[model samples]
Target: MTLSYRVLIALLTPLIFIYLWVRGARAPEYRKRWSERLALQTVPVQARDGIVIHCVSVGETVAARGLIEDILRSYPQLPVTLTAMTPTAAELAQKLFADRVYHYYLPIDTRGAMARFIEKFAPRCVLILETELWPNLLAEAKRHGAQVMLVNARLSAKSLRSYQRFSWLLGPIWSALDLVICQHVDSERRFQQLGVARERTVVRGNLKFDCQVPAATTRAAKQWRTELARPILVAASTHQGEDAIILDAFARLIQAVPELLLIIVPRHPERFREVTSAAQQRFSTLTRSSGQTVSASDQVLIGDTMGELLFWYAAADIAFVGGSLIPRGGHNPLEPIATKTPIISGRHVFNFQPLFDRLTDVNGVRLVDDAEQLAEQCLQLLQQPVQGQTMAAVASEEFAAEHGATARVLADIQGLFPPPNGQARTLKMILTSNPNAATEIWFDDNLATAVSDDYFAPSFWRQKGQIIGSATGRASAWFIQHQPQNMLLRHYYRGGLVGKFNRDRFAREAIVKSRAMAEFSLLLQLRELGLPVPQPIAARYQRAPIWGYRADILVAVIADSQDVFKLLLQRSLTAAEWQSVGATIRQLHQAGVYHSDLNCHNIMLDQAGKVWLVDFDKCGFRTEGEWQQANLQRLLRSLLKEQGKAEQSQQLFHWQQTTDWPHLLQGYEQA
Candidate 1:
């Protein structure tokens, strides 16, 4: 299927160029940057080893603004390359980001073009917005070992059926996606049906809900409203067929309420003149770009300018989101919802059907079938100001409830690219000084409060009546109820001959290189790689005496779990359970992690039988080599030693060298 796809695309390359040339006749911007579209231009130095984000057009570019800006702020050292398929989206990106991002036209999806693109940019990760799944683009990116993620992804029922029809070609491509951050659960389910693994898909809510309405935009809207002092209806992002219906509705609206003004904004730039002409035939109209004041005689205002859709929604008493009156799947209604403006739309909003349906259920949006219904809904809202205000308030509340998607997305992105090995802090980790003991503490800000020396002391938790339990190991570990979570606190102690003299103190070194700090940092990196390791809460290094320091770490405790050694002593594990344990170890090895001590004592199983590895006292990342196999052999030795002890004690041992080991090896090899 892929071979045939490649051949088909190759044959259509000339026609694609001709289509671009034809489009350039009406929109000349398409004529420029032909080299970029063909992947023939030189790659910018700053863009290498960075991130690439592809937004198909203006709407996607706008939807991705918050995410792109957050990525730039979070990883300033890494450059970002923004690609768009249309001139409008490219122009918007350039205008919004300026030189902070490198802008390029996404090349045509020929194998050669995509290969050149992947080779040139060498992006560490590729983020595709919405449903723009180009097979060659995905293939080349994966071929070069770049993580490919689908951001703000959505799939309508219609789109799902269409994709299913071509499953032979798209199945592998969809299944290969590293992650799909969906806007809705419905989309996630559709993607799963189309072959995306359930574990790889997550519902992050809609990125559009996280869109911010700037204070300056609000002030401008207020000023415009005060000047007009009349009820206004904003028909925003109107498609061709929808504009005629909206204009017809406006004509009826004026007969009942003569003072109401209508502002219509078309979705595409080329239709601005056409929409303006259609509006003028029925009523006195003024264009926004003309710099002419809208008089009482002029009942229609044409919003032909760019980047002011939010402003229009904010200034209106009622907003009718366009594209739904036709089969264009509606523009996003969250903009008006953000501005606290009542919304009306047609029933063909399959693109955002879930959101619209929820809004309709809450009386936040009114669905109209045609010009008559659109006019009736507009007149009702315009005549009854309190009703419109109530709807707006409801919609605003719903919008507010969904506002943290940008932060969630940023958190996930942080997980994708952990900081280099020696960096002191992850993006969410914070450092603070403990004045009591002259200590430095590194903690995850999301989990911990202000850290002090007392946090490491069991006496503090005991005094607070928060200590829950204690475990005896080479040293002692205290488990405590830490406000919102259960945490395990362990004080560092030397083992072997070294432990005889210096049990708790060691030579002073850089705080980040201390045993507690190193393990905490390694756990953070491992978690980012999606490993099943304990979450690091906090790590502290306290100055003890001359040239020495005492270290301690606090980590979240896995609930309802027992060590594999203990579980095995209790009863025999199924072959499937053994296979899962092997797969978990293989996953860690694949991430280039060296577990340092991979023994039965360190491996655990939760209530659900999920495998987890713990105790990273001396573990760190290493280049792939024989060490991975050696780590497995060490586990095997531990199992044999335990079996020998069990035999000597006349106890039942669950593991068999020939049977269990083979299952583990099969899982490891397959994984």
Candidate 2:
């Protein structure tokens, strides 16, 4: 080759490598940091069907430990593999299952990741500890001929509502499962409602009940018990924004029972420093049990260690489980119960309802409504040791009766992990015929058309802005089909593409059009229901600015009708319209749908002077008194926005007496 060409190649080689390095660094961080370690799973050959057990985290791993030992004892020749998602759980499994079972981190839920994982381990059966339902993981497992089952499954009511919203995504995943061994009847019923076949779902009481409480080290327990020389209250698994509430409660109990000792354990060990600082600031004398030394002067003791909750429970007079009192679902209360400690908890216990309900039914657990209540309950228990021990006895009895579910669950596992019968059915997925064709059709645009320019390019955004038009009014409309690489727009119609207007602002222009369409449609639907609402002619789902997911409703602008708040300010509406608005609010409240937002913007008026309501996103099943009070407060806010609070409050009180709530009561009764 020529000298110039040779020199050029030499210079560009290093540049190419640099360019590749930069590009690779810019790529999304796909591979997890610990994934490589997980990839070191040993493949078993000439082994019995692989026993794959999935435990979500530490608690689950601990619960499954007994079951794992049982499974191994039953079939020592069977190769066993354990998997966990969290790094903490993986480390815990490594320590517990070391040299016994193959341990690995679960792959990400992408089809490629799951495919690689299943291909490597070749597990005959997969047992998910709880409700770890990933769509791609389940689908690929079933596709690759692995039997799947959900063991120790528990579904809450709130979880039920969330799953209902995504039934489309969950339906196929549930179908892939061979069986679901739920924890309670309520959980089973919820799963059945979501289309999991009733026959496939079985109620196996919680494995936590079967967990053998770690025997307390006699020397250690004796030393701590002597050091305290008083009754101890153990607050286990406390979360952020909860320590203060628990501390306040503990302080109150301390006043009543002077010999009370408080031991607080936060959920995450990483927050040890922060919690220690807070404890020191709150209590005059605080002791951190990090080392072997145990001090007697310590007013509040902070549990900064790990895997010692059971030991602490064994050393306690009563247990107060955290992550409750606040809005968060409470942590597991089963440990305390199994330890035979009288349990006290806040209202939020959705996560451990079955155990909590059983404890409450037998008067073994105390329900504390707030911080004060929690402290009061703790004080009552400590002052009355006899009563506390009685409660603890009930807890022990309830837990003992619910044991032995692990064996029943193991019996069910054989059905899913069966021997190979014949060749497995194979089905190839056909994503597309044309390799370059756009896959996701959002409205009508092919996202590929926008590939030349980057997403944030000034020129691209300028063009996009122009296509959307000015935000003030309706400008233009376009169909956008988005792909991973780019976005595409289709300009022509199916029959005759006649309308051709602004070229620059198609994306910005769709929102006003969509909102107008939604508003109009809502009005039309309301009119059909014979409810008072503005008249509407047309409606459409706007498919531009927000990737076509949000459709705006539009209605004709009322000529003379004003919003009730605006009318009230001008004194424009007759007494009849005001009465109608109040009556309509009552009617809606009685109908079991409360306007959760309860804003005046939601209330509309027509030219004929009729009142209407909009926005169903925040609506929910609420009490009639709450809805009425909320709506009244909303009206007062709107009036205060226009006029002062004095004017709003004056009119509010006047209307309260002038307007007959009894007439509105009649409208609500009629509805």
Q: Of the candidates shown, which would achieve the greatest lDDT relative to the real structure?
A: 1
Best by TM-score: 1
User: Worst ten-residue run, lDDT, model 2?
Assistant: 425-434
Q: Per-prediction TM-score, please?
A: 0.61, 0.53
How many Å off is the CA of 109 in candidate 2? 0.2
- What's the C-alpha lDDT at position 247 in model 2? 79
Our tally of clashes for model 1 stands at 0
Off by over 4 Å in 2: 1-32, 36-49, 94-99, 156-161, 189-199, 216-228, 252-260, 284-289, 369-371, 415-671
**Candidate 2 residue lDDT tens string, 63-168:** 7877787776664545677877655576567666676777777764555556667756555578898787767567767765668899899888888899888664
Give residue 330's lDDT in candidate 2 (0 to 100).
91
Writing each residue's lDDT as its tens digit, candidate 1 over 1-671 gives 28878888899989988998998886788789999887988864346657899999998988888999999887765668999999888877887889899999999999999988987887778999999989999999887778899999999888999998887655378866899999989999999998889999999987888888888999999999999988899999888788888888988988999998999988877787888999888889999999999887889999987788889999999999888988889878888988889999989898788789889888999999999999999999888889999998988886688888888877877787643444333423344555665587877766787777788899999999999888777888999997566999999998889999889888887565689978986787587667899998888888886769989999999899988898888998889989999999999999988988899988999999899999999898777899999999999999999999999999988889899998888888888
User: How far does residue 273 in candidate 2 sit from its true spot (Å)?
Assistant: 2.0
